[model samples]
Target chain A: MKLSNLLSEKRPAILERWFDVVLETYPADTKNFLQKQNNQFANPVGHTIHQGMESILNGLLSGSDLQEFSTPLDNIIRIRAVQDIAASQAVAFILSLKKLIREELEKSQRMDSFIKELSLLEDKIDTLVLMSFDIYMQCREKIYDLKANETKRLTYRLLQRANLVCEVEEPGPQQND
Target chain B: MAKFSAKPKDLAKIRYTPPKTEWTETPVEFREHMFCHSAKPKDLETVGFPYGRAWSAKDDDWKLPDNWEQIILQGMKDLLGKYRSFQLFMDICVRCGACADKCHFFIGSGDPKNMPVLRAELLRSVYRGNFTLAGKILRKLAGARDLTVGVLKEWWYYFYQCTECRRCSVFCPYGIDTAEITMMGRELMNMIGLQLGWIGGPVAACYMKGNHLGLEPHTIKSSIEFFLDDIETLTGIKIEPSFNRKGAEILFVTPSGDLFANPGTYTAMGYLMLFHELGLDYTWSTYASEGGNFGFFTSNEMAKRLNSKIYAEAKRLGVKWILGGECGHMWRVLSQYMDTWNGPADFMEVPKSPITGTVFDNAKSMKMVHIAEFTADLIKHNKLKLDKSRNDHLNVTFHDSCNTSRGMGLLEEPRYIINNVCNHFHEMPENTIREKTFCCGSGTGLNASENMELRMRGGFPRANAVKYVHERYGVNLLANVCAIDRATLSASMDYWVPGVGVAGVHELVGNALIMKGEKERTQDMRLEPLPEKEGSENV
Candidate 1:
């Protein structure tokens, strides 16, 4: 099936804006990291994050049949596992995806924009999968309601420091070794 | 699928009945009392921009009811009527049940009502019947019931039942956080004066005085002095974290709680030691020394007022650079709001550690440093002395906090510190750890004994993973850089995962160090050949 109708035709601008937010929020250390390693988005962490997203997005794009980065849904829920590196919150991260959807749909035509929008929105929702798993590991601790100022600063600092993380989820379960 | 169940004889263990008695009742109505309402609509136009003036507890005396029962009922109503986001989110849920299986607590406790979406319905249903157009028009025809007094009391009960972990948002198609529900719940409960004294007392203290611990100036400086001596004793270093030193190169600020507490204090020591090693010109601000940002748990004013102290103090000191401590929410406040409070601190200088000349341009003035980022840069540049052999037995694994790890995406720097220092660093199960990791069961100050069951259940998933690694890999040590995770997880690890120990990321690094006075402590690479490790177990 076509991807445009899924997103209902607002995917291109969403994609650019989304990438812009994610890229801008990329942590200071990340650019530093790229320079130091002399590899752009090709580090160990980068590969894992890209692979995780590739599986989730590609799966939805191909009508849930994409098996390239396949891992059963229960074992390793598809999401941005490496994003936990730089501190983030519910707003900015989700916003990044929303931005991505708008960008993708904006660039599409009437014939396929709808499906593309839906597909991208589906890909964007992958953040929830990432978040649920993220909160699951941390559920070991007490989670508090973030005070308002905290909500703001934490999001900003996280945005500033976004580039530092290796957003790659290497497509293997925790090795039994 | 495993039947999710938790009869947590949590800290102040409550007597448990059989499954029939506990699980039979549908206690969904209790969702209302724990949440508050908005005075305005969400700013969907500019999604990130807050829609209305922020909610403040300072002015919470807004016409509460008389006669205690009616007062609570009235307060609960006012709460639902208060925040626009709470109201908007409640009105908007499509009940897709997308978040049904995402709750770790619901899974751990085996409570069906614990499902995040259903748990939300406990409050949302009331809002619908009372305020929403559809519910009011067809209350009798649909499942939408009126907000009765009974519902108000129930709202108080179950809303407090949630730990505000935000797990459900991950599955939410619209990305709604159930933690927001919990926060609204808490805000409403406070309005009615039905409070968990533990968090309430600290909130009041922090708003009035700056930190949760409400540490006084002399005591704070003295505490830093004491940690300095402790470092001197353990690592044979006599470096003092200079306080109020005029015109220092960098201003060091941390949650004063760390200055007094164990693992936090140790983390503070790690920062100071690294500064000393680098011979950096950093001074501690007695005023802005509080990096905790208690304002985070309450209203924007409290958060802003608390955060403003740091910038003002920075201005007072005339320092060109500022650094934050290893606290989770503290980093959140520092990273986002500082620029808003005093835009573009023109006097502020980009941090330059003379010890490690790794230039951080983005981190110049408008940036804050996660201690691990700073330390990772040091290690990456080979500035600090090395000893990989001493950390062999550590078998360290990282406990990534939701705030620092996921909120900020600071995964690599901490791991860089851990992998560089510890020999056998193991990763926990993929989805159950990292940016999407679980909370330490007490991150938002849900550490009261009354919340013990929540802590135990919330913390069970993490304990299970630690148990997995410890039993499987002989990984006796859990090394995390976040102070709260170390403190809370250490408590849980000792209680649940016996024979396993937890340490700060720096403690491990410090242990494996070629200290300035290594001969005095212990010459060998072992973490501590001396008896120093015996009692130095705070962080």
Candidate 2:
């Protein structure tokens, strides 16, 4: 059987393991709360991680295009980007999935073909990590943008009040003299 | 095992679980983005706060006065005696954990200390250790700890984390207002000159200049004049709003945020349009320009001092009653604390609507009416012609600003106003609205740029609810009745759920209000084109 088919069969277990790996990055109290809370609105960070991980697992197992993983990666990374974590740790969850998949697959019958397919799957995980990095940067950039925009928004009318900002006139049709 | 390796097993060994020490024993590591900068000495001096010195949260030494611990303990002792609620809150918490999960900060960041119960325990433990005999005899066993610099740092870190939105107090069976505890906590900290710059700066500004932004009298006029320009462009009716004019029937006071900020400025325009349409006799006061009191975040006396401006301005202007604009904590202070602090507003009448003759008997003591209550009364009386379809572009969801909802019991007025103004309005999830509403998470001077990460975490639950409505109902706009909500929720929306904009409740009213003999408006107050006019030549 192909590694993808094997991954598809073990999707639920792999997703859970991946989520556990991600949750481990948080403090002990946070991990406990994230694991215990089931309400999505009440535990949004946990919900976002769970939902994002599920979508990411599906995208990986289905051999979807790497670009298709943007939304799921964004769902998770957007949170981590603003969380009190290092940038490396923010995207480290993507790499942890490679180990999680490997550990999950090790329980199955390991044929010669599995090794070759495993390397290819690992390569895709690597690419996903790269994509997660881009998503992380985008989320960070968006935060900075929001910060700058807040100041601008706060001072916008004040600037106009100060005669510092003015509306430019729209270009009128040239008169044929 | 090697920390970094090409092999997956070796790499996966780098787990990031926290240390296994108990919470009280664990020292706080003041990381960047987790805390705000300390208050500058100048701001402290401006308010005559004692022990004012240059300090940073990142520093090893906070440069405290030698008797800082004594000051805190004495301050706590005075507060315990002065405020019965403070002492009761200190003693009466059963730790039922009803409030543990209610904090938006806890739900978002998963910090155990962010839990309202635990956050309060940080102070209660000290009270136990120092104030009670049981705490002195059996310290650790009684859950009491000595007031070390470490504990003080912990207090500063956790207290500021609280927005004082009081979602926790709602769930507490004993009705322990943790917000007051936080206020007490902040008040004690201010005794040591440990106020946050965001809170202190604004408190000082509001103290000196009558507004948080410190816009001078002429600047306030010009700022409103800028809004007048937009209102004229939109409705083609030039609104000449009075400033500091005596003998006006209503003295209008709003958060200076409305006069300075984006969506808030739009809301300011709404108030102008609404007042102009009704031809109400209202005057904006430069002296009482700020409705939202940052002084409330500092100390009770400071809050009282700042709040005195409104009644003073109203008296000076000789207004019949005060009509407050759409703001969150301002209404909380107005409805809850204003009369107690600066009351017997006997000079002003019982806020009877000049247009509809509807008496707001609820505000008879305070003699101030919320714009929502005023607008709801207007709509109920059918006093104003509203073209609700004008707001068709916005699939609106009302975010009950924490202060307005939980603090002031102003649950219905904003909703009534929204239903009357907009074509499409959807309520967020039941738990996330009304009395149980989550904060914008940037309240009580926590809305600083340095603490964006903290704000984002604190805002996650609110934004999560907004995301639900945004995805399900295609809700594009978050309508709130708070200026802070208008400012902070915009950042939260942009971060968590992009494409959904935040607006003041009055901004929607400005959009839907049809003025007499006004030219056809192609745009809303934000100068964005109206729904029907979108992509049309009229835009």
TM-score of chain B of each: 0.80, 0.96
Best by DockQ: 2
Query: Each predicted complex: what DockQ?
Result: 0.01, 0.49
The CAPRI category of model 2 is acceptable
| TM-score for each predicted model, relative to the true structure | 0.63, 0.95
lDDT of 2 by residue, A1-177 (tens): 788898888888888888998888777867878988898887889999999889888988887898788888888888887766667778888888888877776677564558888888789989988988888878767767878999998887777766788899998999998
Q: Candidate 1, residues A63-108: lDDT per residue as tens digits?
A: 5543333442211221121122212221234435544654554655
lDDT of 1 by residue, B222-293 (tens): 766766766776666688667788888777776665654445555666677777767778898766657776
Cα misplacement distance, residue B418 of candidate 2 (Å): 1.5
List runs of model 1 lying over 4 Å from the truth. A1-177, B1-64, B67-88, B140-143, B341-347, B350-366, B517-520, B523-539
Q: At residue B205, give the lDDT of candidate 2.
A: 90
